[model samples]
Target: MSNYTVKIKNSAKSDLRKIKHSYLKKSFLEIVETLKNDPYKITQSFEKLEPKYLERYSRRINHQHRVVYTVDDRNKEVLILSAWSHYD
Candidate 1:
């Protein structure tokens, strides 16, 4: 299995700051660490977005939140685009 390097964007960082719940924040971090190791692992629940999102992908964090990202296989990197909530 290939290890992937995870890179979080500024928008995603801002999103993290907005997470008021400690448990949710911790869950997101744990997911990120898992992504860093093997982004394509089925346990991450990674899914490709709709055509409107083009090459973007998403991983569910919980019932209300998701982490949006894109995989760069050539570079072996996972570019985290944003942390999205259903409310916003």
Candidate 2:
């Protein structure tokens, strides 16, 4: 069983379906699985957004894509807010 739970917002779900590349989609899914274990632990390209997005965080899916989320420490849940190509 996973230590933390991951929940995707409706907007993020829509964004996920818009990914056109299968390989990219697969990679994003893999990262999300890891997020279920610990959203704050994936430091490769993860960043806590600045003042404008306080309490929210982002992890790179690739050079162009990103997964934005927020962590609820009290409940041990990771709420996925968005998944989209940064340049889009």
Candidate 3:
């Protein structure tokens, strides 16, 4: 059972649609599933993004791209704010 419900914003949905690499898209989906279970669980690239990103957290999809999201513990939700190349 998932402890957190993952919600992707329309902008993030647009970002996913722009991904040309099939494998990278697959990796993004897998990471979303992981977030549903434990949004705070640290992976190789998972890290909190404060000061700059407020309460958001980021997880790398690759050297170029990442998923940026914020977790709402009170409602058990994870809102995906962005899913695209970080340097863009």
Candidate 4:
């Protein structure tokens, strides 16, 4: 399989660095893999974008986590914005 190039903001990178649980770390990696496999799932969250946030992409893992990202269509990169444990 080809490698998918993903970009993330500095703040977001710092945020990801703070994750403590090993399980969540594994799940987070899985989420990135899933994004490369199915990008349309990113576009599938149009209805949920908040007023202050740009509605680019999202994914739900199990029932407790959300992975939100900003899509760079020109470069075909998924820039992860922030991850929330619940509706934050």
Top-scoring candidate (lDDT)? 3
Q: What pairs collide in candidate 1?
A: none
> Per-residue alpha-carbon lDDT of model 2 for 1-88, expressed as tens digits?
7878989898777787876555687878777887888888857888888875479888888898888889888999999898887577
Candidate 3 least-lDDT 10 residues: 16-25
Candidate 4 structure quality by residue, lDDT tens digits, 1-88: 6234676677666547644343577667777787665555534332245654665666764356667777656677777777656454
The sequence of per-residue lDDT tens digits that candidate 3 reaches over residues 1-88 is 8999999888777887876455787888889899999998878999888776488899998888899999899999999999898677
- The reply for model 4, stretches above 4 Å from the true place, is 42-48, 51-53, 86-88
The TM-score of candidate 3 is 0.88
Off by over 4 Å in 3: none
Best by TM-score: 3
lDDT of each: 0.79, 0.82, 0.87, 0.62
> What is candidate 1's local distance difference test score?
0.79
User: Candidates' TM-scores?
Assistant: 0.79, 0.85, 0.88, 0.66
Evaluate residue 18 in candidate 4 and report its C-alpha lDDT on the 0 to 100 scale.
48
In angstroms, how far off is 70's CA in candidate 1? 0.4
- Poorly placed runs, candidate 2 (over 4 Å): none
What are the RMSDs of all candidates, in order?
2.6, 1.9, 1.9, 3.7
